[model samples]
Target: MAEFTVNPLRFDPYKNFKFRLKWDGRYVAGISKVSALKRTTQVVKFREGGDPTISRKSPGLNDYDALVLERGVTHDLAFEAWAAKVWQIGVAPGSEISLADFRKDVILDFFNEAGQLAISYKIYRAWVSEYQVLPDLDANANAVAIQHIKLENEGWERDTSVNEPTEPSFNSTSA
Candidate 1:
């Protein structure tokens, strides 16, 4: 069976440049970069008592890598707010951390070249583990100030509900 039923003619894979991150029911602005989603499972090896030479392997715990989101420095307080939930420097005794609503589920949406929604993935229980307010300043170098946040997520799965969209074609006639 063909993988892309809607766009069967598409031979090239989707590009990584067009993507958006959404949380708190709204899209996050200035998300320039996002780390790859990766997961690994530990392999458990065991040897039978009778068959000493042979070893069997089984799947163990699964570990999901932390996701890093980067964007140009702006006045937005979304990143700072989320990071503060995990740990804050100044606050009353133990009220620094927002334990009640720290973790959040974020949606990553990938768009096609025509700005159509192509795919999406739902990150489960993601919480900010690290936050970078500003990048190193250089007097001679010309670059945008980038801020980033590292999110520790329990797991993530592709949003199967978002299927391959029917690509649009524009027809132009000569004047």
Candidate 2:
């Protein structure tokens, strides 16, 4: 198996920050951090030589599986890590228009279109530093977001039950 890592990319005023992909072959593409990890990693297989008509094979799914097996994590967690990394970028604003800002907008758009409402809403709230209602998109985001929320809620319930005291029987007469 070939090892692929992302080098910290420079802050570009005009273009998105680009990570250097050092795999078996040198394939460089400037990807937004989230796209780099989530989408790109999955379909970016093979260093060089594939037709555009075909999709790139990526280690993303493999990595997700590895993480699930190794750490017993959900795919949402794994993909979120990739998405978070993609969203983290240095910004330099030239005349109030920043590439980092543009990348963030694109990520939000993708997140919305990809049916990641909960995640997207959370990110927006955190970034904006406010508590606001999240916009409801189509069923796509609703499905994925509900899945994530359900998993998270289940995990919380499991942990809470584990820590809670069991019910005890009491005598009929209590002083």
Candidate 3:
């Protein structure tokens, strides 16, 4: 029989609920959902002149998808204040707009069962791309109103450091 080798696993399976969503520096509240960071590549193909069976393949641009987050509507309209800078630029009268006042970084952290920081992604140049409010008026059903926000960023990098938060965290394995 051939020798079988196994690769060492460094991390245990982490929970989903034990996560943090921080924009710039402070943690963004009222967040109920978030999206996973994803990357996709384009395939370019070229045919050789001499041989019909010969073909060349090359990689193209890298595309990153926007992160979607939703939360229960709260009295604190802090997100609106920040989003106005990005959305209300054309309507509001102003000279040269300052990007520093609009664009901000976002960090998504995932924790393990022990409430320790396991994996994180640092989203770069994140800004409010789209915002929507869906209010359902029903006489029989009772549920909290939820607000959705889509964040578009230039790129993101996965963080493998041991930088843990100083506050309480949770762990949920529920799907």
Best-performing candidate as measured by TM-score: 1
What are the per-residue Cα lDDT tens digits for candidate 2 across 1-175?
Answer: 3333322332322223322221113321222232222212344555445565655565543221100111112342432332333333354433333234322211221212222211211111111111112224576553422211101100100111121122234579868
- Provide the lDDT at 95 for model 1: 89
lDDT of 3 by residue, 49-89 (tens): 99799789999888889988888888767577767767564
lDDT accuracy of residue 103 in candidate 1 = 98
lDDT ranking, high to low? 1, 3, 2
User: Between the candidate structures 2 and 3, which one is better when assessed by TM-score?
Assistant: 3
Q: Quote model 1's TM-score.
A: 0.95
What TM-score fits each model?
0.95, 0.14, 0.76
Model 2 off-target regions past 4 Å?
A: 1-133, 137-164, 168-175
Q: lDDT, candidate 2, residue 77?
A: 45
Name the lDDT value of residue 127 in candidate 2. 18
Write the number of the candidate with greater lDDT, choosing between 1 and 2: 1
Better of 2 and 3 by lDDT: 3
In the predicted model 3, the residue pairs found to clash are: none
